[model samples]
Target: MSNVELTNMCMIYDRTNNRVLVQERVKSWKGIAFPGGHVEDGESIVESTIREIKEETGLTISELEPCGIIYRFNDQTGDKYFVFNYRTETFSGELLEETDEGRVFWINREELLELKLSDGFKERLPMFFDRKFSEGFGTWNEHNISELKFR
Candidate 1:
């Protein structure tokens, strides 16, 4: 069996405001991105997503719509990483201003592309908004350069 690491990310949308929740991460892999984190052992992917969002953004989210997935394989390490992507417009609770992960805020959908996004995050946008594509596959070389393609 191949070694794999599972993680998740969620795009919390506000339909009424035409915006989505974003995190400007202060930790590793910092930059503009969605709120999410690793799935703990024995936790379902969906459960982990809910927990991560709550911890990072202080919101209780539900009715998740599974949008797509992004997977990457590292040639040197022989490990594969998978990020199950989801989007939901249904959420409740007080929003957090900041967390150990980063600062959380809502931004207009159109303005998202204008900001400096985290590495590989720009390519993942289509999977969230474009129904035509449902997957992102990335291959990482020994040099750590990645080539990503969507389908």
Candidate 2:
């Protein structure tokens, strides 16, 4: 059956020291992905990103700039998924002691790329690093990013 299986968002927070917020998801999928989660009912995309960051990292986002959107299509069933990508450098709050999702903390931008990351996130991390904003569509399996269409 056709359905929007999920709505999620990823955030890239530059702490001004070349560090960013990251989490290694343990409960669900395995890998280091940016701090984010599924969007709840009626919450706007931006709102969901903010809420997810706060819940998962104990950080209150003060500024969020939409960078792009990623649309994932299931290679097997043709189902679709959407993930909003955002970048921010302003926030307030102490880091959470721990999260059920995984360990949340700051890591150097260059060093973070060396860690094991989720497939989709691994492929999209460059976009965030380069600070390029665009819309993208790709297969969900490997996240073969076809091309980034800048808006």
Candidate 3:
């Protein structure tokens, strides 16, 4: 029998540059990742993503578009995460490091491919660029992430 874990976050794309926002953790892993985090109690995925964006980027996600949902399963351990990915079309405020997660940077679509990131995100982000905004929870079960695939 297999089970799953869940995490919440937002995927903010820079409208002006066609780049995406990410932060590089300063600690051990020293990797880059998006600016959102786990969903807090009593908060919806939308709420968590907005709050995380503000905290990590020092900006407000004013107009968020529901991009889609994803589920990522680890091939090694057979573990998984329920991911809620969103598109922030409109926003305000300057981005700054507001947490221990790391310093932030805006990376181009091609550059995103090279950065050392949470493997899950790197594998799943392509769908966002393709506009596969499906409605439903994503099910990641084996290092296999399907755009409109849900479980």
Candidate 4:
């Protein structure tokens, strides 16, 4: 009857510098997450990214390039997570806590896997590094038989 609440997560990266931005979730979350939240009414996905970047990390993306869209499946059931991964070469702003999202940090690519990243982020991050920005989604394969098939 009603549309599920969708989230447009921002996965920021700078491959030339071998860097990416992530946030440490609060105790309840127990993992690191990309800086993003709900897409507000009267705002486009790009607008939401800009607003979220400012609110979460207090950074303004000077040059953002969309890398891809990802499906962050729910841990429980048929629900899904719609994420928009974007690349930014530069950001300028003071980091602050305007929302209850998490603690922000900018780490190099080599360090991402070491962090306690969100459940599906590991599966979705490679695309960004490959500079593959397009329409697509990633999902966990529940069975070995369908491992290579795209659902």
Candidate 5:
């Protein structure tokens, strides 16, 4: 059986403000990015997503609309990584100013591209905003070079 790791990320959009919640991570993968985390064993994907968002942003979210997925494969180890992407305009609770992950806050949707984004996050944005494509596939070699495609 092939080794596969599952994770999730979500775009929490505040339609009223034309902004989205983003985390300025201070952890392994640093920079501005959406809030999410690994799927716990025995937890459903959606359940895990909801839990992660609440933990990371202190906001209880619902009515998630599946956006797309970002998939990566390590050629050297034959391991696969998948990030299930989602976006929602439904959420509640006061947003946390900071967490162990990073500082969480809102940014204007139009200005998203202007900020420094986490690695590979720039390419993944289309998946969150565009409805036509549902996948961002990438293959990484031993050298860490990758070729990505959207479909």
Candidate 6:
């Protein structure tokens, strides 16, 4: 038997300025990722997104647009994980100096592609910034991306 975990994650984008809130995860995940975290046991996806952004970036999320989900596969453990991604442009509060996750900062859209990003994040970059409202799905392994689909 295998166990699956559900995680709620989001990317905070300031559309007006063409920037995004990102974290250089130096400890745990060890890569550049958006500001978000796991969804608690009893929390809804929206609630988890809001709470996680606040905790990780010190910014309170106001609006969230459903983007899609990332389905990750662990070949060694036979475990599957689903990470729900959301897009938000509205938030409040000052950015944090440090977080349990890592150092946080806003990056310009063009420069984001040049940074070393997580495998899944790099594979799904289009979905994060696409203007048309839609959903996306992707499957990835530890070091490589298997497939990516968007609608």
Candidate 3 residue lDDT tens string, 22-83 = 78866533577766677777787788888878887888996677666666555566776676
Per-residue error (Å), model 2, residue 85: 0.5
Model 3 RMSD in Å is 4.7
Report the alpha-carbon TM-score of model 4 versus the true structure.
0.74
Looking at model 2, report the run of 10 residues with the lowest lDDT sum.
Answer: 142-151
What's the lDDT for residue 102 in model 3?
82
Residue by residue across 1-151, what tens digits does model 4's lDDT show? 2244455666666667777778887743357777877778888888888887888888888576777775544334555656666767677777664357778877888888998887556756655676643655444434421111112
Which of the two candidates, 3 or 5, achieves a greater lDDT against the reference? 5
Q: Summing lDDT over every window of 10 consecutive residues in candidate 5, give the lowest-scoring window.
A: 139-148
C-alpha root-mean-square deviation, candidate 1? 1.4
**Candidate 6 lDDT tens digits, 5-116:** 8787788988889898889887656789887777788899899889988998899987798877767676666777777888888898999977878889999988998888
Worst 10 residues of 6 by lDDT: 131-140
In model 6, state the lDDT of residue 22: 89
Tens digits of per-residue lDDT, candidate 1, 35-149, equal 9999999999999999999999999999999998888998777889999999998999999999989899999999999988998788888888876578888878567767678
Assess the local accuracy of residue 144 in candidate 5 as a C-alpha lDDT between 0 and 100. 81
CA lDDT, every model vs. true structure: 0.91, 0.75, 0.68, 0.67, 0.90, 0.79
Off by over 4 Å in 2: 75-78, 140-151
What's the CA RMSD for each of the models? 1.4, 3.2, 4.7, 4.5, 1.3, 2.8
Weakest lDDT window of 10 consecutive positions for candidate 3: 133-142
Which clashing pairs does model 4 show? 67-133
Candidate 6 residue spans exceeding 4 A from truth: 74-78, 131-151
